[model samples]
Target: MTTLDKRQRVANPTYEPQPYSVTGYPTFRSFYPYYLGEHAHPVCLVGTTISLSVFVRALLAVLPLLSPAKQFAALRFGTQGWKSVGKLLLGGLLQGYVWAWIGHFFFERNKPATFKHPFYSLLGDLTLWKEVATLKRRP
Candidate 1:
């Protein structure tokens, strides 16, 4: 399959850190190609999607607890509702980590890039989803 072929090329790679810092790029224009290169393995795409989904789920859980919404929610559904929201946020966090670990260790057989470059890796994850979803990049 085309997807499997693409993954094989990136699976057994060496780490040659680019001479320039990932954060050193003044604009995303200079940084995006490097980000895409880092995530060429299909597993990275899977892990990033899982991670971002969890984040969005957590945000959805937390949004109801903010300011005016918090008061309205409390009055409408009481403490039990707030407890469920907290649980959802915690679960999202746990699931995100677990999925990321699985993707790196089992699927990619490589350490997560996020450990070294948090900001750029995150942007890579988010934009990678867009690229792949839009068929601009292949997994």
Candidate 2:
């Protein structure tokens, strides 16, 4: 709403993202082909790769604090650590969506399924990320 509100929101992010699923597809196997179709544009693929890289690195950075040896609540990351988590998660999400949107609107000329099918779209992104990472497919 206001500058103060934005700062407060960023300082105390209320959202915690978790993987979810919808009835959009009976199984991920059934959905992969459709996901591939939506991401046919080269720009979309590139954007996805970059976003996933950032997100994975961020997740890795934050993961040690969550390990069983540390006992999640007992391990304190303080302000900087928290900020790192926020930056990685938010930055990757924002970056990916922006590029994907641009590709969809300008190049691909299609509406992103992310709006209607967030869970499936996420699965699609991760799946593609794996393919690209393993050099199975080009992103």
Residue-wise lDDT of candidate 1 within 19-105, one digit each (tens)?
446456666656665555544457666655665676566566555566564444432322555786666656666666677768777
Error of 2 at 36 (Å): 1.1
Q: Positional deviation of 75 in candidate 1, in angstroms?
A: 16
* Model 2 residue 89 distance off true place after TM-score fit, in angstroms: 1.8
Count of backbone clashes, every candidate in sequence: 0, 0
Q: Which stretches of candidate 1 lie over 4 Å from their true place?
A: 1-31, 52-79
Compose the digit string of candidate 2's lDDT tens values, residues 1-139. Answer: 5544543432112222222345566766666666666666557676777787787777666765566565454334335776867877888899888988898899877778789778878887777766556555554
| Candidate 1 global lDDT | 0.59
Evaluate all candidate structures by whole-model CA lDDT and list the values in order.
Answer: 0.59, 0.66
Candidate 1 global Cα RMSD? 7.1
**Every model's TM-score:** 0.55, 0.61
